[model samples]
Target: MIRPKLELADIFRAHGPAWRQANAGHVSLGQLKVMSAIEACRTETLGGHVAGCASCGHHHIAYNSCKNRHCPKCQGPAARDWMAARAEDLLPVEYFHVVVTLPAEIAQVAFWNKKAVYDLLFRASAETVMTIAADPRRMGAQVGMTSVLHTWGSALTHHPHIHMIVPGGGLSPDGTRWVPCRPGFFLHVRVLSRLFRRLFIEGLLALHRAGALSFFGDLAGLAEAGAFAAWLAPLRKSEWVVYAKPPFGGPEAVLAYLSRYTHRVAISNSRLVSADDATVAFRWKDYRIKRGDRQRIMRLATGEFIRRFLLHVLPDGFHRIRHYGLLASAGRKANIGKIRALLGQSPAIAPPEAGAEPVPLTLREPCPCCGGPMRVIEIFRRGQKPQSRAPPRDQAA
Candidate 1:
């Protein structure tokens, strides 16, 4: 694939220094590190390697990727590898897409207490599904789900939400059989919404009572228990958005959907239209519109653009992707084996032992010059130049 003329790296290199200076102490260490990593990615600063095609005289120099989870240019390969690793886990059943969003009031608090609140969001959303699905009136089964957290909207705004992919069916409560949903339905959004709101509110209040939340500026009044509870009372009256789309075809389709949601950063390089000293422009979807064209271009002052991008810098060591229910890491393989059996399929393969060596994933991208294999011939450290003088290749990014 040809590279986009504009990139987050280009924007960072051009304006990051000035923006960093202007914001000084306001930036968190996590955001600063992300900026530094993106600025140095794919350049000589991080070093690289030389790959040569033995069948032909072609050679190329490929720079090392920072492999930062938040890097726009880096997520492609990351997503591919993760998909590969998860390929074996897919079941031959339809999958439903569910989204649960935090209301604006709670989102504001989440911004300040990211780790605490985001953790609660994951637990609450997961429990809401497990609880609702286990009811005899509902599916009455132990379903599995994969949840991905997205903290930014299309315009790089702070809109925190969870995207979940669930199998259209689940194992019976007694683990005796498979239970499938109606062909065109999953769960009632209204029921899910009410339960999610209640669980999340209860969890948030627990955190607050445990002195886990922080408040500042206009929200300082929330430091008091009475004020905080009263503030949340209004949210109880309002409806939170919970949407569940019809089930996708099957596991492969679910994999395709996950490729987009799982490893995504706030914005990708392709979305960048242009960046200059004064302004940066990019494409964003206007979701508020229900008809006609929803695509729109948004331009922000360079400083503001950088600020908005940094707004999504997740806390260090925080996980953005998680599995729950039958997908829980502990007994995933065994659970899948049982579910597959109930579906009249062969038993799933077992994973390797604790200290077993992993099989390498081999994806051969033929040489651009000739349809021949390309193999790494040389490795170099950061700030060092490769011995062979081959032109840089897009294979690296």
Candidate 2:
């Protein structure tokens, strides 16, 4: 496969030092660590291995990956492992894709109080969905959903939203049978939007009153109770975004969607066009424009680009992906079994091959010359050179 002309590492390598020096006080320790990790990823600084094909004697060197969750190069294998684990949880039912977005007012507050606001976003959205679905007038069933948080827009701007993959139906309240939603719809978006807005604001206020939320910069004045209430007043009446996309064709489509979103970074290497001493250029979509016009190029000075990228480095230990209701960790196994039984589907089984140890998932490249599997015969530590090995007799002089 051909390598792209530019990558996130390229931008970081070119301007990371200067950016760190210039904004030493402004950048967080996590952001700085991310920069260093990206810069060193898959490079000589981290050490690697040399793989050679026994059949064709074709040799190649493979560098080590940083395995940082935020690295684009490292997401592939991580996503695969995650999807594999989630495969058993899939129900043979139509799946709906829903997105819940925080309004600009809350987004600004979230920018300063990321951990708190993001937690609220997840809790409020999950509560909104399960609440609406449980209502007798609505679906009247217990639904399971996997929600993933995305905090950046196409241009790497701070835009926090939750993407949820929901089965089109759920278990009946009595847990005796499957309850299917309307053939073409999941729930009323208007109702969800209103309830989501109310829940989120209420949660935010509760956090503030408990002194869990912090305000800084321009928002410092909002620390006052009256001022915070006033700031939230307009938001209560403002429309929030909560929309469900058309149902995915089947389980396959849901898995495909999850593969892309479950481990995505702010920007992918493919979207990167070029990186130079002063500026970095990348592709971005302006959704407000027509479809054709939406795909456009955006260029930012290297430092600014780094800054924008760092804006998405989540608070340490924060979970960006979450499960709710029936999928909640505590009782997911039992809930899934009940759901499968109610749907009249047998439990999924993993096939085993006699005398075969399971092949661990990886993203390493195959042998180029013979198109065979490649394995590391030896490992080298950082700053150490790989030991030279003699070529096969066929190539010996």
Candidate 3:
């Protein structure tokens, strides 16, 4: 067996409280809850159970996981559950990965108004894709997309962007047949960049008019209409960043990519190099650098590291994953069925029964000594030790 490396929980357990006390005024309730949850995740504070091997009689204690979306240790099971539900939605076609990123100016405002700005980001990107695809000169189909919101960059900075997994084709406007895109191409990035910019800026202006946006710190003056319009002036001429990667090899590749991005938090435990009382070190990628020099180490004071991690807590109940166009949940089942029928393919997978419990992927690892299944023979309450079971008379001798 291999031991796990350093984790985010370790850093939180060591420095969370001190950082919270120093920045109590700046931190939100949601951020504080996330910090507390990460600090106590999988520890005795949460609870645990005891599992024993029936063949070898070997037993070990296992702690409960926090199950918080922000917890690094909890995302594996969450991603698996999400994937199970999404398996039925796969189409028999190539998929494209498109990214829409906000300029630094907008990102600065989005830092304080996360919910509003992030919602605008999703709306603008989805509209751009669907609108362009529907044009008769373009793909001339109604595409479906799964868009995920990511608020942090590789260095854990507040760089807001959208990651969209889009099928390479769509249903005809009349729903009579499947419409496929060009073999390996999806959309023109330049066109998407222009439309996304117009839509996003227009939405931002509307939000400002409705008094739904707030400006503060260095951007406080933007509350005035003149200042806000002036702030957006340069953005109109500057090209927005919209990138589209080549089509995925197949459906399996799309699932593999979604598993990584769907539930990712600011940073994963594997990137953490070390943490101490005064400072922490971690690996980060600098995309601007050459490929071989991209990987680099970043060290920051413990408090600052914690602060940067908390920068992405998100407003409570704000969804980071969303679907649009044909993939929208309202009628996704019917839409998928129609598409499959048109393509002369059978259903990819059956949907789960109405009230069935999700089947566990694996109950437990095999016993190390006997290679037999392990069973949870007893459950121990928090702070309680497992009671020892007496041995058989022959074995006692």
lDDT of 1 by residue, 1-397 (tens): 5678899999999899999999999999999999999999988899988878768868888788899999998999999989977888889888899999999989999999999999999999999998899989998989989999999999999999999999888888889999998787888889999999999999999999999999999999999999999999999989999999888977788889999999999999989998899999999999999999998999999999999998999999999999999999998888988888878887656667766753322126667777777778888999788999888886533
**Runs with alpha carbons beyond 4 Å of true place in candidate 2:** 351-365, 389-397
- Could you arrange the candidates by TM-score from highest to lowest? 1, 2, 3
Candidate 3 matches the true fold with a TM-score of 0.93
Candidate 3 local lDDT, 317-341, one digit each (tens): 9999999999999989899999999
Expressed as tens digits, the lDDT of each residue in 1-397 for candidate 2 is 4455678988888788988999989999999889999999887689887666556766656668899889998898899989988999999888999999998888999998999999999999999999999999999999989999999999999999999999888888888888999997999999999999999988998999999888888899999999999989998888899899999988898899999999999999999998888888899998998556688899999888999999999988999999998899998989989888877899888645565653442225665566666656667789976784633212321
Residue ranges of candidate 1 with Cα displaced over 4 Å: 348-363, 395-397
Scanning candidate 1 in windows of ten residues, the lowest lDDT window is 357-366
- Each prediction's whole-model lDDT (CA): 0.90, 0.87, 0.87
Task: Point to the candidate with the largest lDDT.
Answer: 1
**Candidate 2 lDDT score relative to the true structure:** 0.87
Per-prediction RMSD in angstroms? 2.3, 3.5, 4.2
TM-scores across all candidates? 0.96, 0.94, 0.93
Model 3: CA > 4 A from native? 1-3, 351-371, 382-385, 388-397
